[model samples]
Target: MSTQNYLVISALGKDRPGIVDELSKAILNIGCNIADSRMTVLGGEFAILLMVEGNWNTLGKLEEAIPALEQQLDLTIIVKRTEARDSTARALPYVVDVVSLDHPGIVHQLANFFSQRKINIEDMATTSYAAPHTGTVMFSVHMTVGIPADLHIATLRDDFMEFCDTINLDAIIEPAQR
Candidate 1:
């Protein structure tokens, strides 16, 4: 079997219609596969992170084509070579959900909590919005964390709950659904 080469591509530009179509079409035309991707619009900017896979030649072609792509799409593009994730380090995936009155440092605090415990935060998303009735600003966070298999779940949950309480945040830690 042939080995696959991977490239991580990130692009940012003014948001508009057809950006995804054009970008994706270009990748396809270059004979590369989009293994995984995240796309979003933040304020006025369209941002994308893509993991592309192909044989050596195709990936080289994609890299060579990037400057023109950036010019055509009016985007800032960055590309980096990467390999597949190591699967030997096993862990249990847990979902952490938090909501509280909007305040600064929530993300930092959460990051600290996990960091102190040596847990890996695999993914996270946070948003703030006004409450329905009072229009009070509220912030919410959803995170996927990798808890080392050897860690005790019950103890971790207790500690997480207590930590959240101390910070005036409502939170839950549960096994992630497969």
Candidate 2:
């Protein structure tokens, strides 16, 4: 009997046509199964987030192959090992969406707040664009968040309210399940 290990990898670099193929093939050759993934273009960069499961014997093989692929494709690869699932119960995940005028600090501000509250952001997508004479680009972000049951939901809501006020941005935070 054997237990499998999961590795999470994030890939990012300048956007190009075949980056996905290169990474996908590399994963296949290493005998790992990509359990989940999201690949998209953001701010002229192609980024991929993948969760893959493989045996220990092949883990190093996969890790070693990444640098070669990186050099050939001019990209950066980040990989980390995931811990075994916790046996205890976990809290339900939540959703937090924010949209505002694009500014230098929008991401930084939100990230700082999320970190402070121990909110695990499972996934996030952000985009921005400028309108004629608008002077500032509009930015939109959707985040899938997880909140531990012990945390006060009201506190999270209050934090968002305060953050919104300080940034002059509109935000909505509510029970993810109604």
Winner by TM-score: 1
Count backbone clashes in candidate 1.
0
Residues 86-155, candidate 2, lDDT per residue (tens digit)?
7574765778788888778887888888888877776788888785696577898888787888988887
| Candidate 1 per-residue C-alpha lDDT over 1-178 given as tens digits, one digit per residue, 9 for 90 to 100 | 9999999999999999999999999999999999999999988999999999999999999999999999999999999999987798889999999999999999999999999999999988899999998999999999999999999999999999999999999999999999
lDDT, residue 170, model 1 = 96
Give the TM-score of each candidate.
Answer: 0.97, 0.77
Flag regions of model 2 displaced more than 4 Å: 71-74, 85-89, 131-136
**Candidate 2, residue 38: lDDT:** 94
